[model samples]
Target: MITFQLSKQEKVVKSINSPSNNISHCAFLACSHSPQCTTQNKTCCAYILKHSLVFIDTFFKHHNLSYVIIYGTLLGAVRNKTIIPWTKDIDIGIIDMTYLFTKKIRDELYQHGFHLFESFGLPRLCVHKNISNRTLLATYDRRHKPPASTLELKVYIDLYSMYRIYGAQTTSKTPVFLIKTGGSFHALISFQNRVTIDEQTFPTIDNIEEHLVYFYTKEYMHGIMTE
Candidate 1:
């Protein structure tokens, strides 16, 4: 892992594999579904994503964390003011280390029609009504259905560990990461190369819904995937 100079002994997310400093020109949007799921519909899956977004946003807002629309969520935000009409899931993001404080957020949301799912040492996770507690974060869908869209509103969020570099392309894909805060491995990805998220000014607010499940140690975090 690459090390940077810091005054405090803080953990900085690092990518084990480095992409070129040039604008990332590669994109790997895996349009695939889980093996457990077969039929994925906008209504069923969108309900899960929508409920998840509301819960995440409201819970996090109570804790005063800073998050923003990311990836497909951001794209959808710009295109339709909501999840892409046909899209089945939603994506939101926060700066590194916010997940360290998710327990409190989870506890509070649980009282408001949410269910908490045990994640071992991972951050506290929750689900909407009727969602089953699985190892893959709590997920909920409208009942009376087999499965329309395989979109499971998993306890996953896009993490943007962008770097300070010269001549990065906004239109091209930039190498980005999604570090699970359960103190485990990290996930990597090439972001859209069009503009740098680091350059964009996300709204600064009091971060209330933060958790450690997304802010684990740097070493373990770097081992996550770039998929």
Candidate 2:
């Protein structure tokens, strides 16, 4: 059974329970180029993205927190009805609720087989799966060679904090919400209403096309299609 022990700041420590080896059906060996292999791999990745979203949706709902799909993940959902074939990570934005419950969220992700690691620095969490200690060592070892083991090493999801900018100069045209990425960068986002993906609706930015233009250049649609 999975359990959580929270520190004063609510940082989660590893539990005594060992991580599970029962990989989900979405886990794939790696990507390949032969037409058949490419198709199968893309299908597998799309399934994983869908499953990951379901878990995220359930978690946020249980916590009574509001979240929205964003970035490249949203583009894929809106345009292709699935994850972009070349995309490696999922992105979501939560409105000012994650900080207070970091440990709880980390523990929950751990229970579901995700290993949380800091990206850019400590406390900014990026959760991943199918990445063992051995794989991590191989990544940094100079002598280690490719074609490396691809037991789903890159399945990860990024969580962004959404906050409203409050100040005297802020105006209506100023975005209602800011989605903070790692470090100091933030992307402006506005929530007009919701968007449906795989028949489940979730909040999204108003004028998604405009937001997409801001986040990606005018060539965004063309670029995403190439790979």
Candidate 3:
């Protein structure tokens, strides 16, 4: 029998190639499901929120388009002055835009490493990051699984189209603004104004509290805070 000795470089390469050493730093920590990993996940989500907002603001400004903070995101901005801890996404509404615009926005996002997914039959745009070889592991609770591939990319910005409803009895062609929610479009007649949240300014309904109640009901606010 002949015995062979491996060189330093060969040894290092062999160790790296071993199955035990193949685990990625992120994958190892994420798989552990420890509190530290949970905190890291939240931190990653926060970064995504900040970066996504900046990207959206830049894109809209370049396109000469205006967007309004709406839904839960609007509520968080108005009350907490920051993103809600439990909030997983951002919501914004564009007035008088068509679904065709989403295609353009998707293409623009692709250039910046984001992939756009449109909800079927709804004027909604969800953006995610492109990644490879990532799999979501079931959590201890089984209900909450950490985002598999796009660790920091789990956060998404939702873009909704606002339209003005045309009443059957009215003959005037004046444009109106309506927001779609729960599979139906509701009239939005509130005046919009600029508001600053976490040093970033965006358009929101002038009467924010009332607007939120109108869309989500007073009980919804209570539930959000309590739950």
Q: Best lDDT goes to which candidate?
A: 2
Counting clashing residue pairs in each candidate, in order, gives 41, 0, 2
**Residues 1-227, model 2: lDDT tens digits:** 11223212322323222232122312232422231221124334444445567767786778777777888777866776656666656777777544424666656666664544434322222223333422222222233232222233444566666665543133345355555554333334455466666667766666577656556657767644522
- Compared with the true structure, the alpha-carbon lDDT of candidate 3 equals 0.48
> All models: lDDT?
0.35, 0.50, 0.48
**What is the alpha-carbon RMSD of candidate 2 to the true structure?**
10.5
TM-score of 2: 0.61
- For candidate 1, what is the lDDT? 0.35
By lDDT, rank the candidates, best first: 2, 3, 1
Query: What does candidate 1's lDDT look like per residue over 1-227, in tens digits?
Result: 32223223334533222122111111112222332232233223343445456556666667665455444554433333434434534444454434423455444544554433322232223333333323122232333342212233332333332223233333334322333343332222332122122133222111111221233222322332212
Off by over 4 Å in 1: 1-43, 96-102, 114-227
Query: Which residue pairs of candidate 3 clash?
Result: 163-178, 164-176
lDDT of 1 at 124: 23
Query: Cα RMSD to native, each candidate?
Result: 15.0, 10.5, 19.8
Off by over 4 Å in 2: 1-43, 97-101, 122-152, 168-175, 182-192, 223-227
